[model samples]
Target: MAGPVHPARGVSYPVTALFMVGVFLLGAAFIASYVGGLHAPHPHRVPVAVAGPADATARVDAALRREGDAFDLRTYPTTASARQAIQHRDVYGAYLPQQGRLLITSAFGPTTSGLLRSAFAPVAAADGLRLSVQDVVPADPGDPEGLVPFYLVIGWIVSAYLVAAIVGLYRGMAAITLRDALVRLAAFAVYSAVAGAMGTLIVETGYGYLPDSPWPLTGVGALCVFAVAAATAAAESLLGIIGTALTILVFVVLGNPSAGGPWPLPLLPAFWRTAGPWLPNWAGTEAVRNAVYFDGHALTRPLLVLAAYAAAGIVLFLLLAGRTNPVMRFPAHSTA
Candidate 1:
């Protein structure tokens, strides 16, 4: 006789096939979105501070306008304010026509600095002058592409989600008490500290890719890791396995591409640019840049953003503890 026909084989086979197809589609979509979003970046109303006499400012503004809304030009009374604006992150670069100089912060990302340079070069050329480029905040030599901070943030985010997945797996296997949730959170805190230190050392000390003092970066990294991890834990606690997928969808798929790390915010399309500051990846990235290059200038916004995420995560985790799956529920009469 032929081998016994499996009772559920027909149904199982089709379900498995469909599941694999879904996985394929997910991968395809991820690739397409990332590639399409970043393949070619053009500036859109990139803020630039210009300091010069009235006639010179008018001339420069007219020239920039001809470039089709490529720059949002603002006139500063003096070069000092222009430099301050760049340091404050109000502008990516500045033009001082009196000195015929272009001020940039490579810490903003080399690609953005280059774009600013090219955009203003012709204006200077038209006046029979060569633009003097001044790097107010140069990127560390070891990180010429200025992507180490972004990679560090990405690493922290990955670790956070993975730890959340593991915690979720345990929750699936058995009920988790409030005390158990606290223990898991404490463990994540320790992990965040260790991961932050290790990442700071690797990038700042080992590779010399970040010139900032290691302590601030370490602290920021710790906060970032904790924020992501706590947020993931809260997600998993509230949503179960689906929460893990949501974490990936939010942090990885949506957050990473719009992060403004590889390309500064000005170069990104409108949606991503608008969303970048609201995301953890961009917040962490900008905080790191400020710590390393701008002497922590304009660090408040990004730090506040990270802090908000961390706070919300902790609150959510506490609220959701002991309230999820019955398998993780505490027995009604048990004190423990």
Candidate 2:
């Protein structure tokens, strides 16, 4: 007789396999995100406007062509048109021949601009031209160094999310239903308004750090806060305790360092640049800059992205909430 053949003890092989698969997926996610973030930008398809008189146009076009993979050059008859293109989102930048100046309006990461600036230098010299720099859309005065509005918005986002997370823990993730989700979101809106008002007031009147209309800042701040809180609530609803870690993974660890706040996206290493725009951190930063510096230009895309995140979170929380374990669920909490 064969010795007692004990069936597999503890976890079954299939269960172990499933567990391994989950681990693999998570690991893959981290690797893919991390590597994608670092991948080098080849200056592929970067739009630029070139403007000058007939001869100047031709010369500028030639120089831009020689500049290679970096520039997708478009020609304009006058500098005003180029500026218009930039303001209208037609181009990231424009070069003016008569003034020998380059106009930048887009809030591209700093590294990309630095690269362009340096590249323009050699080309300008070789072509017997001089270079001057102009920022059609400048940053806010109070924004610390390169990251002013970025950090401010980040602060608001973190606070709101912290509130949501705390509420979830204390109250227990509620038996969130469709109505409940909407109510939560509605509550989020009110909380957002308060947070935004306070943050904006502090930054503008309280500290005099930002020189801009306080109302606009407050409005934008409210939107940002809502987005973050909604997102946190949704994440907590989905992942239970793991949601907090995931939040750190997405918004803080990945979001902050990669946020174009301190160095601008381009100035960051390749990985950070690629991942920056996809995260709420980048969206919030861009939106803040648009409201304060870019004359409200270039804000639509980022705002839409943030709105999408908020909408998605609300939908997820409402739809799948019934399946959640009440004991493990996140109720009203503070993420601040």
On lDDT, the candidate that comes out on top is 1
Cand. 2 Cα-lDDT: 0.71
lDDT of 2 by residue, 213-287 (tens): 677778778877888888888788777656765775788767876766655554456667778888788888877
Tens digit per residue, CA lDDT, model 1, 52-98: 78999999999999989788999998999999998888898999876
TM-scores for all candidates: the values are 0.89, 0.74
Candidate 1 to truth, TM:
0.89
How far is 26's C-alpha from truth in model 2 (Å)?
Answer: 11
**What's the residue-level lDDT of 263 in candidate 2?**
54
Worst 10 residues of 2 by lDDT: 327-336
Off by over 4 Å in 1: 1-22, 173-175, 326-336
